[model samples]
Target: MRAVVYDTYSQDLSSLEVREVPKPKVGPGTVLVKVKAAGVNPVDWKVMAGYLDPLMDAYFPVIPGWDVAGVVEAVGFDTPEFHVGDEVMAYARKDVVQGGTFAEYVVVPAKAVALKPAELSWEQAGGLPLAGGTAQRALDTLGDLDGKTLLVHGAAGGVGSLAVQLGVARGATVLGTASEKNFDFLRGLGAVPVAYGEGVVERVLEAAGGKVDAVADFVGEQLETTLAVLADGGKHVSIADGGVAEHGGRYVWVRPDGGETARLGELAASGALKVEVAQSFGLDQVAQAFALSQSGHVRGKLVIVP
Candidate 1:
């Protein structure tokens, strides 16, 4: 199978190389999937650049992708929930081989895989796992968003966009922060759009009519500003760093949850959740995909069609 492999951390895209490697074998409790598409997240590039120090235990020569949408080619012993030829999507467990989704095929735990939404194409399905899961976790960390006023920082990005849609579905009046260009897009997702930058707190507070009931800091650097705009005792959550101590709110690190993945698929299938793949690249173009993610201005998720 051909995949993008990197030997050392470097900011240069040239460091990523396309090469052939042996196909991974499916072990017990695992399912082998023929990769149709793989979603690229900021974490993928961060890991490749050796910026994720806490994840160093996973070792090197890693594949560096967690979101996968593919068809099952085989199933290992003890895996009864899925069968050969089933179309599935998953956020592969982070502790495992960094996932092998960048190749023609990869293996993931059966518990991590779920049926993909019928309404979504492979590209859209591939983009949902990581961002969708993060959105769910961030909202869940807050007790309840229904009838509350919510603010999402960086609302035009993958996770932030999903968070806005999800918060609206949960009955929250959502205000999202994005650049002026993405304001319309955010409003289309049922969120009030506020331009991010100087005086962002004032802008958000103005949008929410003085204060918001909750704030999810998808962009960590603006944590202080987000907190200042929230109502007293409002839920504050951040996925980027330890926001618990700073804002007196919960801090979350998204984990693979088959239940959440299946629920999200149902939402997509029912037209309640929508995933946008802003860009697509071939397997050999993984370097370019990584470079695009590093730009920090992607409107939606990027996928690699292998």
Candidate 2:
């Protein structure tokens, strides 16, 4: 099978190259998927640059991705949850960094695989897993948002946009922060929009009619603003900042859950939740995709057709 592999960490994109590699063997309780598409996330390149080195182990010749939407080709022993020809998607992050979804094929634990909704395009499904999972996790951490006011920083981003939709579905009036160009986009997602920089707290407070009941920080480095805008006794969580824990807010790292993935697929299938794919690239052009992701200005997800 062919895959994009990086043998060593480098800030430069030169380390990533496509090459023929040995096929991954399906393990017990796992399924081998023929990769149709993979999502290119910030973590993919961050892993390549060793930014996550302290958090996870990396094996050499690592394949660089975790989000996938593909068809099952085979199943391993005791994996009764999936079978051949089943379409699935997953946030298939392994404890070790290797055998990633960027390849022509990837072996995933059956517990991590969820049926991909037929309504979603391959790119949309591929891009949905990680970002959607992260957004879901953040919302879950905020718990009981019904009839409350929720604020999402970087709300036009991949995770933040989805968070807005999820919060709205739970009966929360959502306030989202983004650049002027993305205000319309956030409003389309059912969020009250506020400009992100300079006096954002005042804008959010004014928009929310006083204070926000909950806050999800998808973008980092705004502890002061979050503190100021939050209502007394409100909940706050940050996926991007560990410092949130120090300030009595929760710090979240999204986990892979098949149930959550399936629920998101249902929402997408029902046309209640939408995954916006900003751009896509062929497998050979992954380097360019990673470069775009690192720029941090992309409005939605980027995908690779493997």
Candidate 3:
């Protein structure tokens, strides 16, 4: 099988090579999937460049991706939940960064896989796992938002867009920060849009009528701003910044939860959630895909057809 492999961490794209590698053997309680598509995320490049070296282990010749959508080709021993030909999606991050979903085939724990929603295209399904799981984790960290007001920074991006829709579904009034170009996009997701540059606090205050009961920061470096606008005793969480914990807020690192992934699939199937694919590239063009993800300005998800 062919995959995108990196033998060492390098900022330059030269380290990534598309080449043949031995197929992964299925393990107990896991399923082997015939790869259809994979989602490109900023973390893929960041990890490749050694940003996460102190935190996670990277097995050399690593394949870089966590989000995948594909058809089940075989089930490992005792994995009775799925069989050959079941369409599925998963957040397939393992503790070690190897055997990722950037190839002709990949293996994932059955528990980490969710049946793909029939309503979603393969690209959307592949893009759904990581961002959707992050959004759901943010909402979970905040507890009940019913009848409250919430603010999301960078709400037009992959995770933020899903956060807006999920927040609104929980009966909270969601106000999202983005550029003027994405205000309409945020509004379309049921959020009141506030421009994120100068005077952002005042703009958000105006949009929320002077109340921000909670906040989820998808964009980093906003701890001070979050402290300024958040209501006293209100809750907040940041996925990008660890400094949030010092300010009485939580720092979230999204983890794979089969139950939560399944819930997200159900939401998409019911038409209550949507995923936007900003652009897609063939598997061999993964370097180009990573460049686009690193730009940090894409309005939605980027996917790779493998």
Candidate 4:
């Protein structure tokens, strides 16, 4: 099978290249998926650059992706929940960083795979896992958002946009912080838009009519603002900063849960959750997609179609 591999870490995209590699063998409780699409997150390039070296060990000739939407071609022993030819998606982060989703195929644990909804295109489904899971995890830490006011720190971003939509779906009145340019995008997602720089706290207060009931901080570095705009006794969480814990807020990390990911697929399929895919690239063009993610200004998901 063909895959994009980086034999070693680099400060740039110079190491990523497509090459023919040995096919991964299915194991007990695993499934081999013929890759239809892969989602490119900033962490893909970060992992390649060794930014996550202290956290996870990497093997050479690493394939670089974690989000996938594809069809099962083979099922391993004892995996009764899925069969050959089942459509599935996953936030398939492995315990070790070796095989990845950015190839013609990938082998995943059956516990980390969920049925992909037909309502989502492969690109949309491919892009949904990591960001959708991160968004859900952050919001869940804020407790039930129903009838509450919630503020998202980076509302126009890949994860932030999904956070805004999910917060809205939970019956929260959401206020999103973005540049003035993306205010309409937030509005369409059912979030009231607040400009993020300078007087952001004041803007949020003015927009929400008071301090918000809870906060989900995606952009990080907003500890001061999060505290300033949050109601007393309100909950707060951050995916970016562990410092939030110092301030009585929770720090969230996305976990690979097939059940939660499947729930997101069902919500999206029902039009209760919508994933915005900003662009698509061929498998060979993964380096270009990584460059776009590095820009940090993309409004939605960047996907790889194999």
lDDT of 1 by residue, 115-156 (tens): 987788999999999899999999998868889999998899
Order of candidate numbers by lDDT, starting with the best: 4, 3, 2, 1
Q: Tell how far residue 13 is off in model 1, in angstroms.
A: 2.4
Identify the runs in model 1 with alpha carbons over 4 angstroms from their true place.
Answer: 96-99
Over 131-231, each residue of candidate 3 has an lDDT whose tens digit, in order, gives: 99999999999999999999999999999999999999999999999988998898899999988877988888888888599999999998877988999
TM-score of each: 0.96, 0.98, 0.98, 0.98
How many residue pairs clash (N, CA or C atoms closer than 3 angstroms) in each of the candidate models, in the order given?
0, 0, 0, 0
Q: Looking at candidate 2, what is the lDDT of residue 163? A: 93
lDDT (0 to 1) per candidate = 0.86, 0.91, 0.91, 0.92
Q: Candidate 4, residues 1-306: lDDT per residue as tens digits?
A: 999999988867867899999999999989999999889998899899998999999998899999999999999988989988899999989988889999999999888899999999999999999999999999988898899999999898889999998999999999998988888888999999998889888899999999999999888799999999889999999988999999999999888889999989989999988888999999789989999988878898999998
How much is the lDDT of residue 270 in candidate 3?
Answer: 93
Model 4 ranges with Cα > 4 A deviation: none
